[model samples]
Target: MPRPPLPDDVAELFRRPNPAVVAVLLPSGAPMSVATWYLVEDDGTVLLNMDAERARVSWMREHPEVALTALEEGSWYTHVSIRGRVVRWEEDREKALADIDRLSRHYGGQDYPTRDRARISCWVEVTHWHGWGAAKAD
Candidate 1:
């Protein structure tokens, strides 16, 4: 499917170094959210990393469905929201570590610390998305 449009402000927000906050719905009907480092791959997939034992990971394990939104800093009304499914998950320690390193370098311009190697990585396929901006009109 074609990717949705990202408002100019929202697109700029994703380019920053600050982590994006994603709100996910748990299988039990509750909501779980987290601030995660992410990368918008050239293929358009959004990659995320988290500890294997994190609540968001457990929620995804039981329910692959999730909603993600990128909030614009210092603004009350600009954001991008996406509803999607977790299409891939790798349990291989080495591969996950490698992916984390790749993403970190892509987003942070550096490699993942050895301490974070135990974390798991997830790849999300966006099914739908919408973006909006709220900057004052001059």
Candidate 2:
């Protein structure tokens, strides 16, 4: 099936730094989720970052399929859940750190502390999205 287009309102919602949770499939086929920071690219892909050896990253690497839910800062019901697959992985230290910093400013207001390990940047191509801000179906 063709993916849905990300409307302006939904795109704007993703621009904000809110609560985002990523779900990936483990080796055993079980689902695992983690809270993460993300950026929505102009091409509609979701940019996610983490330690090179993190479980989430490993799962995504091995499985490639993942889901992300970006929620409103103060409202749990206001959110967008995206189902996508990892389309690329960028492993440059400088770029990865910068990305985390960019994400930090969006979510935490500043920089991310302690960047000791190598970072992995995963770009997921969005295939589907569900829910809308507060209470409207988009």
Candidate 3:
């Protein structure tokens, strides 16, 4: 099935480097969430990268379903929430590095500072989404 498109206002909000949190399911089916850097693709898919050694990476590999919520700068009430699954995993370390650099540039002005370690990149194919506060639909 085709994916649902993010509304224009919500998409615009995502284009900015806002604070985001991602939630993943644990082995026991409990949910764990952490702050993360993310980039939204034109097709509404979300790009997320993590340090290769993190436990969350293992959890993601074992269970692909995830959710992310991005909050507007200085306004927590205004946010966009997305539920999706990891539709693609970039196994190449070089490509993962590039992805981290891209995310770094989006969040900051320069490339990722730590280049000595491997990174894992995944693309979340958004299946459902909604916005609140200013981006909310009337």
Candidate 4:
């Protein structure tokens, strides 16, 4: 499906130096939020990494549905929100390790060797995306 338009300020928030923090809703209706180094691919998918055993990961396992939002540090008014499902999760030990390396190199400014030492991680396939920013308003 075609992705919804991302508000200009929201887009800029994702383009910030620090990775955006996302809030994942648990099956119990509680929200588990965390800061993650992420990348938005040209295909309209947002990729994030977290330990498999983390609360959000556990919650996602039970309920793959989730919502993600990102906002600039100083301005809560400027932000983006995405509602979607986690369509894929790589549980293979080797692949998860490799993904962590790749993600770190891409977002952490580290070389391959340096990147491999980062935490193990998993992927979240964003099936739908919708966001807006206060900065985009008149």
- Computed on alpha carbons, the lDDT of every model, listed in order, comes to 0.69, 0.81, 0.86, 0.60
User: Which structure among the candidates has the greatest TM-score?
Assistant: 3
Of candidate 3, the 10-residue stretch with the lowest lDDT total is 1-10
Off by over 4 Å in 4: 1-17, 73-77, 111-138
- Candidate 1 per-residue lDDT, tens place, 31-107, comes to 87877777776656778877777777888878888777766666637666677888888763767577777777876
How far does residue 43 in candidate 1 sit from its true spot (Å)? 1.7
| Residue 54 displacement (Å), model 4 | 1.8
Error of 1 at 73 (Å): 5.0
Looking at candidate 3, what is the lDDT of residue 7? 65
Quote the positional error of residue 118 for candidate 1 in Å: 1.7
For all predicted structures, in order, the TM-scores are 0.75, 0.89, 0.93, 0.66
Off by over 4 Å in 2: 94-96, 133-135
- On residues 6-31, what C-alpha lDDT tens digit does candidate 3 reach at each position? 66667888779999999999978799
Give the best candidate by lDDT.
3
Per-residue lDDT value at 126 in model 2: 91
**TM-score ranking, high to low:** 3, 2, 1, 4
lDDT per residue for candidate 2 within 33-135, as digits (tens), equals 8888899877888888887878777778899999888888889888888899999988848675887777778778888886788887889999887866552
Which residue pairs collide, candidate 4? none
